[model samples]
Target: MVEVNQFYLKFEANPDRYTLSDLNFCLNHGESLLLLGPSGCGKSTLTYCLNGLYPRELDGEMRGEIVINGKPATEYRPGEISQQVGVVFQDPETQFCMLTVEDEVAFGLENIGVPHEIMEGKINHVLEMVQLLAFKKSAISSLSGGQKQRLALACILALEPSLLILDEPTANLDPIAKKDVIHTIQSIQEKTNCSLIIIEHQLDGWTELTERCLLLNRKGIIFYDGDIRDAIAFKLDELQEQGIWLPKITQYLLKKRLKTEQKLPLTVKEFEEKPFSLFGNEEVNEGNNLPEAGLPYIKASHISWKVGQQPIIQDISLTLYNGEFIAIVGANGSGKTSFSRILAGIQRPTKGSVSIKDRKLGSWKESQLREEVGYVFQNPEHQFIANTVFDEIAFSLRLKMENEAVVKEKVQAVLETCGLLQLQHEHPYALSQGQKRRLSVAAMIVDDQPFLLLDEPTFGQDASSNAELMGLLQGRYESGATIAMITHDMELIHDFATRVIVLHKGRLVADLAPTELWQLPIEKLHKWQLALPIQVQVQNCLKKEGDYAAQSS
Candidate 1:
């Protein structure tokens, strides 16, 4: 068990004010605690506090105290903390310090000097628990977003701590992997009866597993605490008003204001079994061709790309019209990223050609190609090559050796559009994850390209940041920009995508609209390792069973 007494945490970045202020929490054995909050709410910082990173590794000021199993957490060495409390960070990629999956999984155990003789069994057990046994020797760099997450969980479980704290363990994973990881983590918690604390924004995925929920506001004080299901159902409106993500199915019922059942479902499976009077056809027309508009702005013909003797993309043919927003989804290593790079002309296909406005891509000058197509990478930090936000955004404009006045005006204009105007002087590296994503994105958008290819644009962003990015993209689409995104966030496709493309084993499987996608067999989506959002699934189910028609009758 762990207890925090009137905890106050501050940092040198702000000479005053605790990131988490006057907060008190108590966690007991065999109970799972969910920490929910908006972006920059200090939920993650609070986790660091309980695990002794607050005043130590993070170099911050700490008041009050945290006691774990009747001992001060502050007194423990990091290694000691690792034994008592295992932590899986928000970004699985950043936490990996090893070259291979096996090495990373065994890292903490080896650090604590868990004997080599006893290491194999522990490693195998956790890998099996997290369903990463087959990938034991895989390189960390080659893993899919989901595989990387599973490995992170395996690494912490190998430590076998008395408590497990996961910081958004599924943020980068696809929905299937997210659900699998969530299920596996809950099983481990129930079987071992270890104290569990999970900090996550995707609420619905964890509903079936959560026991106690703690809602932390931006100020870091607990706004609500009690039974997970009851609290969510009780304060559903308030949580939604704060722009927080509730379970998808719950939100569906809440929209209708249906007050039936003691508790609304927090997941797809639970909702499918419950009876309802509302037709699934609340807003969509039946049997109509997905909206059609305009002509192709960019087209590819028989494109085949290769690296050495291996084909990264095979016989890809596609068309992107003006002002269209498309999501390209596939499992990691399925060539979605490679395909994006090709579309942006960042990678050349060995065979065939890409046409932009009836001209071959190879015919365009480098400057002309860049002016027409902009590619944003998955790692935002890597894209930043400048000192400050202003310089980063201004770097390309300056590269043209434009006049100083022109450069300043263009940079300032983009800064305002990307919401980084206030942080113009701040080091790009020093900004928060959300800010860094926006800054990097701003650089690409400032050029005002007609076509954009983005790789995992929303992977690590907070809800607010993701929404802001979506709105910006939507505005651009309305103003005649063709946008293609490679991503793992399925909800993003369900809500914002005008078209969905699924790739499997380096081949295009399906390309259709969101409404049309719901009509396809669910198994096909799963076979491609794609996950449909819960509402889409529920809607599909209701339609198939004539539940909607019955309601109308």
Candidate 2:
């Protein structure tokens, strides 16, 4: 249904540098292809070319041929092409154009000139397919990130395009929400005969659904194009170095030096169905070695925040000790970000109060507060205040009136640590998603504040960068920094957080150690729209099988 031949592309400003070159691929009707590569490798750029958003909207030079449904893609107008190819972008908020869920889903249908009668049915059907029927009348502003993502998919599905493209659809979602989106996509594929092209970093839930995989190199060249299983099993190390994610099961096999000749598991269920000698033999000590309770460095007492008539956070009380890694997690709109803002003095609470080191947060001067606590917003762009990456990181040091030699040394160290040295002179907005995240962190941590707070720190990061960034954060924490992070990555919470705080409906629901939190009922966790990490899920599955075997014996 889709074909590309000897494709080459270079942006207008950089004529000598080809962002994408010699790209070639074809997809038949009802087939699914997974696109995998590191950040800034032209994965999203390729999607733009395929969706007709490249040459027309984004100024760029292009070559070769791209045909959709036996017709040259270049021949069709953007409006006409929308009927054949539908895309659900990575950021759902950017795709919204209407106030209500029903209107947003129907907007695309109306644009295509569908009859009012059929549009009603199409809108309702797609909304139901995505399990958003109950929210059909709700305002888009009130929906959670996960709900917004479903709404985006509903809009695309209503058009019933022959080819569906999803780029990093699960990047910003929690695990349970991620699963919900994954299931909706699978259901759509089963019901409709459409080709699928997914550009994603999360590989857990996509293995079984994808038939083929296309791996792109750093230069945007197609490195591997073949069966999904073969691409993963044979090219595991290569993919890992490319910053692409591998399934946990595959990673385990690789670590154990086990050969995947005739047997390779894609999903956890597949791995469980097959017996392995290595199962249930190792003692995995699961515990967070938190220090004894000390004097509270920061405290929040009965804090509440409301917007007009709606209360977002209510009566939340907590104490954060010095030199501890705390993870604040919850479902979308559960007030995680609101609470973080309150802690950082960005948003004042409607009731109650917060204090830093026995001093009321409000009493601290802006300059003093900034020096004592460093904050990285969920959207990195919000915190950026300089033209170039170099200046952004050096801004803090320069404000302190440090000597040129000292400022240069500190800024360069942070740049190298966060892998932004090469991008020092580049504009912050021009960098890739991963690069932006690194720059944001580099800028905030340059001053080495005593307390650091980050919202969704690993949102757009790839594997290698994630490890590198987290390692840097760990070093900072060890150097007597008190860290609090609002994240949806359960793996990060499990591995790093000394204490896990769960919020639900604007209240502190649970505050416990990572191991203790996991021991709670799965249904209870689901109530907050949370999920276990892949490693924890695997352990639970193995434990259940062992219990059954022992009972039978």
Candidate 3:
């Protein structure tokens, strides 16, 4: 369905640098390919080329040739390739052009000049495939992040393209929603027999659907390409070094060096089917040890926020102590972002009060409040203001009129910590999504605020970058900074969160230690749409084996 021969590309902005170098790959009809690579490794850039957006719509120079559906890519007129290939971007909101769900789907069909008589049927069918039929009339603004993503998929599917590309479609979705979206794609591919290309960092959900894998190195060159099982079994170490995320089961098994009777298991079912045994009695700790509470930093009392008549945050009360690493987790649209915003004083509460160190939030001057609290928005671009990456981080320090030497020193240290020292001269907007996310975080952390609130700080990061960023945050926490993170990654919650706060329907439902949160009834966890971390899942699997052995004895 698609073929590339010695493809190379370089953007006009950086004429001397090649974004993609000597890429060669092909996709057969009805085949599914999983594209894995480190963040900012030209994965997304390659996607643009595949969909005929590069060298035409985007300002870039290209070499070699691309053949799609038996025609050279250059031969296709503007917007013609879209009929054969459809791409759903990482940010779903960017692709939306209509107000309502049905309208959005219809707009794509209308652009393609689909018969008006069959447009409604096509829209309804695709919506049904994505399980968004019931939300057909709903406004796009009302849909949750997951629902919006599904709607974006529906829009692309409505055009009936032969090759579908999904770019991190579930990166922002909660556990349950992520599962739902993945299953929906799997079902649609099964029914349509269309070729698929998935670019994502999260590998656990895609392992079952993808037959082959294409791995890319940081230099935009292909590192490995072959059967998914072979890559995981033979090239595990190489993949890890490249910062690619392996399937959860595979990661656990390889990390523990467990003995499996069969080949490396890529999915949970495969792990359960294969007899595996630990090398020794190595018990894994399911949670972190809770630290002693420090002095109060910020306290919220019966705070509530609303938009028009709808409540976004219900009368929630909580106290954040110095040096606390708290995680706010819940389903999409559960008000995690709203509560964090309220705490950061970015948004005023509709009712009740918030105090920082015994002072009401309203009483603090704007500059004082900003110095006291640093907020990182979920969309990194929203927080960026400076032209260059260095200027962005230095903006905070420069505002205080610090000495040039001191500003440069602080900025250099932060850029090094965020792994963005090389891109100091690059425009903040020109960086990749992951790089942008890191820059936003670096800009906020350079000043070392007493309290930090980050909304999905690790949303687009690769495995290595995620660990490094988290380690940086951990260092800050250890230095008496209070950290509250809003996230959908349960694994992150298990690994770093000292306290877990569960929110549901704009209300705080459960606040407990990390260990206690993991001990909740399965039904309760499901009610809140939460999933167990891989460590906990592996622990349960071993516990079940122990129980079976005891029964046999």
CA RMSD of each candidate after superposition: 3.4, 2.2, 1.9
Most accurate candidate by TM-score: 3
Model 2 residue 406 distance off true place after TM-score fit, in angstroms: 2.7
lDDT (Cα, 0-100) at 521 in candidate 2: 94
Question: Cα deviation of 85 in candidate 1 (Å)?
Answer: 1.7
- Candidate 3's residue-wise lDDT over 487-536, tens digit each? 98888899899999999989999998878888889889877879888788
Runs with alpha carbons beyond 4 Å of true place in candidate 2? 117-121, 131-143, 256-262, 278-280, 287-289, 548-553
Better of 1 and 2 by lDDT: 2
> Clashes in model 2: which pairs?
none
Predict model 1's lDDT versus the native: 0.77
lDDT of 2 by residue, 200-219 (tens): 87687888788589999778
lDDT against the true structure, per candidate, is 0.77, 0.85, 0.88
Pairs that collide, model 3: none
Q: Which stretches of candidate 3 lie over 4 Å from their true place?
A: 115-118, 128-145, 259-262, 278-281
Error in Å for residue 274 of model 2: 1.2
**Which of the two, 2 or 3, has more lDDT?**
3
